[model samples]
Target: MAFDGKLLANLSVLAAVVESGNFARAADALGLTASGVSRAISRMEARLGIRLLHRTTRSITLTDEGERFYAEVRPLLVGIEEAASHAGGASLSVRGRLRVNVDPLFSRHVLAPRLPEFMARHSDLEIELITRDDLGDIIGEGVDVAVRFGFPPSSSLVARQLLETRIITVASPAYLKKHGHPCTPADIASHTCIQFRDSQTRRPFDWEFHKGRKVVPVTTHGPLLVSDAGTLMSVCIAGGGLAQMMAIGVVQDHLARKKLVQVLPDWADERFPLYAFYPSRHHPAAKVRSFIDFCLEILA
Candidate 1:
């Protein structure tokens, strides 16, 4: 079958519909009327002799054929768009949807607050930020970039070092006043310690401390064992217990505000590295590159 401009246009509409999850939303995304989008899909289905979508009163879902077709053609569609942008000399225009997967704590404490400035700089760019503790498959999820702790697990993707932040032990002033401050790492055993658990493993993170060349991991217990860093920090600020956290923007803000006091400052020595992981594409979309650079600048 000869593929014409109309077929390409309908395919684009189909992709928009699949991405947006509905006819109306897809229409809005493509700047077309709902009826126009529906008609385009109907035309494409008739021409291709395949039912692309299963439509209910409330929602629309792709048929098996539609799913397979989308999976094969979506990347091609993205490439075509990128090519058009480059051909039109709009390669510098950061105008597209940018889907990013980010660590929950980093998103909450660092990226989220800085997003407005990034958006203001690139007005045409749309951002979708998914924050979670676990690092999911970025390519499978259609994520352009992932801001995560540690290095990228798979060598298939390109990884860039964002920053290495020091982990510091902290406690609320009220908690310290009530229980007395722990001057040494060994004294942590006497204090109520808030523990952070690995989301995947369900094991508590051992608090690490260093003096000169000697480093040790101290196992401490508490009433609260949280899987979320933000919640753990909140509990510590509310006088729950001593918590060790990455000394990033949010922690520094809290420290400066006197909300949380650094405990065993001399002993805090562990560094957590953050990375920007993305697909190993030869030419990433301008939006992705722009956002990564923006993050690096703000984070620097």
Candidate 2:
């Protein structure tokens, strides 16, 4: 075994490569030539006697060994950088990227509007808010945290209860006036009800109602099926159909402006819990902690 700095360099290069997903891009990011990056990987593989990456013209894929090595070394590199910054007395006012996944409606009407205040408080923090209605694996997706509706899944993740949400049925006044109002759960069967379909569940959610110590599920028919809650709310507002949505999502303007009227007020269930989830709680980063605290303070 000879002394070689190439091993450490290659590890860094490998991280860059994986992060960038291409040799040319990785080289550009690392300020190295593409051939130089390839040579580094080759020499490092020769030194370690292992194939770290599978390369092709179209794409690069990491072998099992490459993945193992990356998982081991990536955190070490991050630690080294953090230690260097710590030794230099880096500012503690929440710096670094905060990757958050949240609902589109929440992101649009709730979080995005108030993000400037958070950004002002954390001047050094760079927040990347990814909006999606679909659920994602936070650990696999490399997200810092996610704001999810309902209870935490049966995963080894840490979750903090942020807010309680109530499901409500809403319909436009014009639609209700033309079609008349439904008095009971059974009335939904004949009316045009907007159905919200979950991608993961692959099924339309039935309108739920409660009656005097009894639970009733109504299977409604509708011409419009929607995945996005924003669109569903819009369709309901435009008199397309009646929809069941979270109170928080539908309450602000409609309840005040009288565009959408809440129906079945006494019948909807109150099982929705908004949660902020992270992969782990063991020595959480300051950025994650600050975001969670903000959500708790503002939303809870």
Candidate 3:
């Protein structure tokens, strides 16, 4: 067996087969016959002298060797895609299926409303917004980019910090009137506090406060626990309990008529940084670069 470029080509084909689940579906995507696809897989394994797939009539799965090979070649395949896109240069008007994963609240409150402008700017680009509270895997999920909250994972993916968001301790005027305002972190224990427990980190909702130079975490409890910020804000507006909210999420109405009151102004620290993350820079696509620049400009 010679270590030719065919190894890379066959690895790509095998990756497609594994990702698409079956030979027929993989062949459909690759525009190859099912037999051709299967042959490629067989040749690949024979060349490498390893069994890569556990195949049956109805299903197909990767062997341990296949998994390792797939992981190794996955980034290479992505690089090829980026190279092809970059080859088009300015002639390519960002015209591709661009899948993005974003937080549900940000999608609804911020991005969704402003999407028409972006679509109008790039008519050829197809945009699909998958809104979820669950943290999405950009590479694993086949997403072009992901809008993430807080600090990004320490990886090769580029994280462009967009904004320094504000977090505020807030409650409905009614709730505050009934329960009274908490003057200190210790006072939170006496009041019912709304909990956001569905973070990707799976940590309990602990209200963090910054008083002077000291930072403290106040463990409190509420009757309700929520994942969505919009829903949490709704509950707060409806007099649920005191909860900390993103300033953008609560600012408009809170500032206008005061349905919600921002409590403990001095105790609140800055919110986490939001970022637009994508893969490597080896093969940079014009459209992807344009989109990233556009995001930075708009957010800045």
Task: Give candidate 3's error at residue 279 in angstroms.
Answer: 1.6
> Candidate 2: worst 10 consecutive residues by lDDT?
85-94
Model 2: per-residue Cα lDDT at residue 39: 91
lDDT of 3 by residue, 68-182 (tens): 9788878988998899766666445577777888877667777776778888988878888888776567888887777777778778788777777877888889998998988
Which clashing pairs does model 1 show? none
Superior by TM-score: candidate 1 or candidate 3: 1
Top model number, lDDT: 1
For every model shown, the clashing-pair count is 0, 0, 0
TM-score of 3: 0.68
- lDDT score at residue 100, model 1, on the 0-100 scale: 93
Whole-structure CA lDDT of model 1: 0.86
Per-model RMSD to reference: 14.8, 14.7, 14.6
Which residue pairs overlap in candidate 2's backbone? none
Q: What global local distance difference test value does model 2 have?
A: 0.82
Give, for candidate 3, the lowest lDDT window spanning 10 residues. 85-94
**For model 2, what is the alpha-carbon lDDT of residue 163?**
87
- TM, every model: 0.69, 0.69, 0.68
